[model samples]
Target: MTRKFTGLLLLLCFACSLRLAAQAPVQTLLWKKQLQARLDSLQRANGFPGATFAAVLPGGEVITIATGIADSVTMSPMRPGHRMLSGSNGKTLFVASALLLAEQGLFNLDDSIELYIGRESWFTRIPNAHSLTMRMLLNHTSGIEEYLEQGDFMQQLKGHPGHTWKPTELLAYIYDRPPLFEAGKGFSYADANYILFSYIVEKISGQQMYDLIRRDVIKRYGLKATEPSTKQTYKGLAVGYARKGGPFPVAGAMVHKNKLILNPQFEWAGGGFVSNTADLAAWAKAYYEFKAISPALRVQMREGVAANTGKNHLYGLGMQIRPGGEAGMSYGHSGWFPGYLTDAAYFPDLDVALAIQFNTDNFRLLKRAPEAYLLDMARILATQVNNH
Candidate 1:
């Protein structure tokens, strides 16, 4: 409490602050190099065709690293800016857009989906159509079975890889099917719910879901590298790879003439967007920080039931929350298309975001899931930030 002691303490604190500020740049460079080396080793050891990783620090610094070959045949190197299918991460947009519309007093989340699409003749055929609410679809509690799990659907998709399917066409596979559970009852992770939700979004807004998402989510957040996967080809898109024996059977490069071998348009609302790691990381940060939506709605998005998808995992609205011990509570989404796999997470406790994308889906060749790689990468970054 003495004046002399207080003055000495203040001087020491100022000196420490100056030292830390001077060391920040050196620490940033070292961490980036370390992250790049780690990614390179992971890709080589795991047989991934290529990988891109991005991280956003608490201080707003962005780090991105790319490794391995982008195109197997052409031998092109993967760049940090190369884009790939983000898979189900697209659901984040669907959920966020719906929330924005709801925030604008356009519609209620608890409203029956039938209120929007009831007039369509085929809507009545959908399981639990009359009782399904928009909230059920957002949280995957609609009880609709997954059309992707149907054998005939996959066979048909394999038969015509180049076909651009309509939403109704995709719904036919699950039409008149038994409900997994009554609407708003037990939880079931089904893309069909989002597909139906997409219809609701369009009917309620009188605009395409893609356009709304681009305007409100992508452009609004300055995610310049993110775009809808409606098109078959995109500039700076990395060529994806998969095993020969899978349902797709596209052994080598999954892209031909810069176009996806399979038309991914059917993924429309189910989850369909392509983005690079930097953009994905930025999106994750903006979203989790509640910049994309109101904090109240974001809290509702995190209010999820136990998701049986993984140990200690929960699926809320369109966001996935998983425990990340030292990294703090993690919230985000994982994406899996035929040839690409992605994982993006934002750690609220640390105020950091990280995204990882692989241009290959050969899980057999890898030792762990994409999210595992993401958490480990996050751990490394967290150490750097914490030390500083």
Candidate 2:
């Protein structure tokens, strides 16, 4: 066999071995101390102001650890309860809620979005408006341009941080824009697809998108600290710090004086939740373990397509599927906001779910990518679980 193919075979074998060894019960206290040490090392090494790490083991045992400062100016020590704006990670919750509605007979995945919001005056203005389906939106195959990538949208967002934007207003940037590609021809990640999805879900269910998420997803899963980023301030929410040379104009305190500088209500179905790593870890465990969705829908959610060429990852519905190497496959999502970066995943072979959140988005300062740190953290926990 070619070297590359041979390498793949060996990697799969190694992962299988790890999974086999992972049946031992986790020693929660030992795992917590080890995780904390790693978290502290990574934080100081990378200059991250603060971070939280959480994991849910095979039998529902949870371990959460925190390190560094939540608000540097106030010298607030980061706590396990501090919630960070989870960025696109919220997409997982949004997509699950949409699927829940479908399970309730409210809609079908193959149904054209036009069937619900097609009559609206602005509906046709969206690229590929007539041909888009709920499945395409869920899987991000709708060929829609990501509104967040548009210069005008970012300008407006940064210019008016407090503006409570409506969905149409956020979508106006891409009103007559061309699709990234023809629908179903290829994969292109786009937040605008989820925006249209929010409209469809709201229209069909006669409830606001956030309400649907809270009712059907969060409440059902008992994710206590997870909620819509609708309000400016939330108790125990961490202050976010932007990278020095980051895209965001504001450098520090994305959440200032206990209030978010940008009104996150506009995020809508496109990742609008702020949550602590503990709740996020719990949500990831429940969702990926098939407790949150039907096994049939769960299968559909795993039907992944190439998200990045040359990357060992795929995008499935709202989740990102990444091979966990010697650990197994991981199903989860990552989030990126101005001053925060978060990653969460469930490793099926090990039956472990992990969530990590950094209060500062200074990835350039890190020795490795934030996702890499999470996988490393997962491997550490996996080994611990195996040893015990």
Give one digit per residue, the lDDT tens place, for model 1 in 73-187.
8899999999999999888887787788899888988888777788998988899888988888888888898888774887777788778888878888888888888888888
By TM-score, how accurate is candidate 2?
0.90
TM-scores of all candidate predictions against the true structure = 0.92, 0.90
Candidate 2 regions exceeding 4 Å error are 1-26
User: Each candidate's lDDT (Cα)?
Assistant: 0.85, 0.83
lDDT of 1 at 277: 91
How high is the lDDT of residue 102 in model 2? 86
Model 2 whole-model lDDT (C-alpha atoms) = 0.83
Give the distance in Å from residue 328's predicted Cα in candidate 1 to where it truly belongs. 1.4
Best by lDDT: 1
